[model samples]
Target: MIAEICFTADWLERKRTELGGVDPALLERALHAFALLGHLAESDLEFVFKGGTSLLLHVPVIRRLSIDIDILCAAPAEVLDRSTDGKNRCGQSRPACQVASD
Candidate 1:
């Protein structure tokens, strides 16, 4: 189930209490993870969640600890005024489209 991120100090403290007896480090990590995932879920960009974060949720009895999140995203191609590709340092033809999200 998708969970909403809460910003209020009371809600945050309550959430910590609900999680119950968690190490401060683990609780901080979990809160950060949920907050980030909630933010991304609220965004318009299309994405595929991957890597350690995925394993943390999907795998059972895994030994390694996850400390990071990874995602792959795609956006519609668009033309731009400048080129950022190093190989296209000197444009032979027209400048390639640039993604402003960078």
Candidate 2:
């Protein structure tokens, strides 16, 4: 599962890089999103790092222009459901999710 998340993140980063010169705001937003994802994965999905986001956390320079953030999860379905369903572990609906889904 960890491998799966890492692969997914890596793929997304590659996609971002392919669309070269993405704006700083957009990059920051993406990184923030990844941080949220990491939190969710850690809290609800019980994910542990397998040297995934460590790269981003340790290297400040890499954080600036990182194509994407990498994360490892043991439960992909839980992550997907939480992400799609817009509910955190506490069962709170994320307004952003509702708006985006709508």
Candidate 3:
């Protein structure tokens, strides 16, 4: 069974002491969001998450945080389509359309 770590003041302080750089509040938020994302993508078979947030969360020594979630879907771009189940989650292995900053 997976044990859930609760966020208390002591835990936040521990993160602050260990990282010694990022704000504790930010760490809490990022970790919380990341954990949620991990759960969201748990059964997903399409996208492979990548980029800075992935790096920071997956790497034990990386204490920095990013403000975005980047993903690279393994399915071919041809399958891109939104789900019709009234949920925003992708369907048919669709690529989430995004306009890059470039």
Candidate 4:
């Protein structure tokens, strides 16, 4: 048999509290990654805030909960070129750097 249950805001807060709070090291790493990405983009191509990272910057509290960084490029081709040359901050391949859009 299956039981149906609904989660409330209070339940979510309890769950978050039980999760032991956010990791300081992880947050530092994420911020470092964002800085590196910004530097790489500035040195190579043009980039603008996009997706979750943009939202996180606007909402400081959200940054504590964010797990990853998101960025948008103005010159995707240039980004690809820099990434292929191993100049990207992430040091990923061009194909890997290619952003997927629907």
Give the best candidate by TM-score: 3
Q: What ranking emerges by lDDT with the best candidate at the front?
A: 3, 1, 4, 2
Error of model 3, residue 87, in angstroms: 8.8
Query: Mind giving the per-residue lDDT tens digits that candidate 2 earns over 18-64?
Result: 65756645654555545555445545455444344456557644534
Q: Which candidate is the best by lDDT?
A: 3
Backbone clash pairs for candidate 2 read none
How much lDDT does candidate 1 score? 0.49
Residue pairs clashing in model 3 are: none
lDDT of each: 0.49, 0.47, 0.54, 0.48
Candidate 1 ranges beyond 4 A from true positions: 1-23, 60-64, 76-102
Listed in order, each prediction's TM-score against the native is 0.45, 0.40, 0.56, 0.45
Better of 2 and 3 by lDDT: 3
**Tens-place lDDT digits, model 1, residues 36-101:** 554455445466778776786776653444545576666444322222233342122222223334
| Model 2 lDDT, residue 30, Cα | 52
TM-score of 3: 0.56
Candidate 1 global TM-score: 0.45
